[model samples]
Target: MKRGVSAVFLDRDGTINVDYGYVYEKEKLQFIDGAVQGLKLLQAAGYKLIIVTNQSGIARGFFSIEQMEEFHKNMLDKLAEEGVVISRIYYCPHLNGCECRKPQLKLFYQAQKEFDLDFAKSYVIGDKLRDLALCEKEPVKGYLINAEKKIIAKDKNIIICNNLLSAAKDIVGFKNHESY
Candidate 1:
């Protein structure tokens, strides 16, 4: 995906931080090691850092939308301390039958409009299959974080990374690689 000047679509729960299932509390936010550094690397490489997450916690009544926003604000504030700036974060709070949900490509399209993203140049990273689903419809690449080795398929365009740090390395490589 060397199409240039594209965004990096990320899944929040497991990709950026630990997913404690409907995790909302700010204190519950445990960032994956190297998550911030990876984001920073992407940001420095001129890639837009956008988060596309599914937060069914709000729809499930486990948390409120306001609470989720506040938590995200806290997350942004924390990341800012480390010189990381997330361009935007999009989340779908639907349990079912929503086009904005992952695997639907709705949010990615929306992001394209607002962020001027080139899908062919973009990247998606997540712990689940839906995170990489956008790649199926677009020409970009996807990275599946196999922290547990639960995903056991050899996807052609999808790279398997041990963590976000490894994914960041590849992203940087892709950006700097001349033959990309």
Candidate 2:
């Protein structure tokens, strides 16, 4: 565990890739506009990119985790083609009310323990409020990529942005911890 390893945690659906409701196929994967660029920018700025996603489809039997992993590998290959390195990916397969699920601190804390993350200086970027919930327990800052355009957030620890690109810009620009 390193003390100064800053990270930018991201949501998988809608933030990095387009969310089309239980998308689990390689052919169905679509990178959101500026996603590659944004990731690259964050990487260049010395931030490790990590993904913490909630994929309840597994709990619902809509898809197996092995299927998800295959498709996820495909997604990672595409990102690697563009030189975007995702440091780690952690997901919850539970339908709800699980320790590793979002709005819960388990996955983030686990990642923290494994990666030696500096929660105080880290950041979270996602499309939904739960994606930013880790901020409720820790001082980590957050940015919401409001791709859905339907959520009305009032949390002071979170900043709302139009998309991943804008969020990345804010993140890299506010490296000194200016909460957007």
Candidate 3:
């Protein structure tokens, strides 16, 4: 068996970038508040940063896969310039009915298979409930970014944070609290 590594499965749209709906243009790529600093903290904490996102714009005909890839490349390059390196990115381009969408374990399992992730110690940070669905099925911790203050976590293990930086701080033992 392969040795397991702890990873942080991040959601891209609203969690990292400004979700302006079906964002496929590289020029539209804008990181949310404190996203770069939060990612840097996670990286410094020795957690492999991986992006797990659901991009249904392809299926909806709003954007092509090539366009999305270009956007991702630009985002990666920007993050790299900020000293935040993403270990991998797994995206489900299918619509809601697909098995690889967020809340489904297919892409998550694929990421685990590729990296031999230690789910027990891993974490998920996203702006939506579906982004933290793995917490319902696995032992990993979940941080629901309540930047919009619209979500209320029902699960005990699912924490509520104002942004990615707060979640990263809590994960790195910089703070001890139920919510931030």
Candidate 4:
């Protein structure tokens, strides 16, 4: 890994694409407004794009792991067609309380180990407080998306944005500011 290699850990549903609960079909996937552009911006800024999602639906029997993999394949193909490449995707197929669930650091740990990431320069962007809470260590900034600002007021360290585009801009801005 390059020295100072940073990663942007993203939550798949709601943050990347529209959260159709337990989504496992490529035909059903929908990208939120500005999501592609936002992700592209992050990519241009040299952040490794890693997806960390909790797919409890697999454990709930709503969708098989193969179905999820197919869905991800379709999603990645679509992104590739758009010139966006996701570095990796890590998902937790276990039910609640699983070590890899959001708010837990299991997936983060795995990513760090696999990628040799500089957690101090990384960030985690998601639609839930749990996503932000997952990165309590150094260089792991948290960004929350909730236009209504309902679940994030308690955390002063969290940056809240109305959409993915705005969140990307905020993260880029923060990174630039820190470099000065």
Better of 1 and 3 by TM-score: 3
Model 3 / residue 12 / CA error / Å: 0.3
Of the candidates numbered 1 and 2, which has the greater TM-score value? 2
What is candidate 2's TM-score against the reference? 0.91
| Whole-model lDDT per candidate | 0.85, 0.86, 0.90, 0.83
Distance (Å) between predicted and true CA of 5, model 3? 0.3
lDDT of 2 by residue, 1-180 (tens): 436679999999999999999868878999988888889889988998999999999999999999999888998999999988998889999987789888887999888888888988899999888899998888888898864566666778888888888888887774533332
**Best first by lDDT, ranked:** 3, 2, 1, 4
Stretches > 4 Å off in candidate 1: 1-4, 174-180
Candidate 4 segments exceeding 4 Å error = 174-180
TM-score of each candidate? 0.91, 0.91, 0.93, 0.90
lDDT of 4 by residue, 1-180 (tens): 368678888999999999979989889989988888888888988999999998989999999999999999999999899888999999999888777887788888888889888888888888887777655655577888854645544555678777777788887774542232
**Model 2 regions more than 4 Å off:** 147-150, 174-180
lDDT (tens digit, per residue) of candidate 1 on 1-180:
434468888899888998878989988888988788788888878888999999988999999999999899999999999888889899999999989988888988888988778887889999898888887778989999854566664668798887786798798885543331
- Tell me how far candidate 4 lies from the true structure as C-alpha RMSD in angstroms: 3.9
C-alpha root-mean-square deviation, candidate 3: 3.0
The positional error of residue 79 in candidate 2, measured at the CA in angstroms, is 0.6
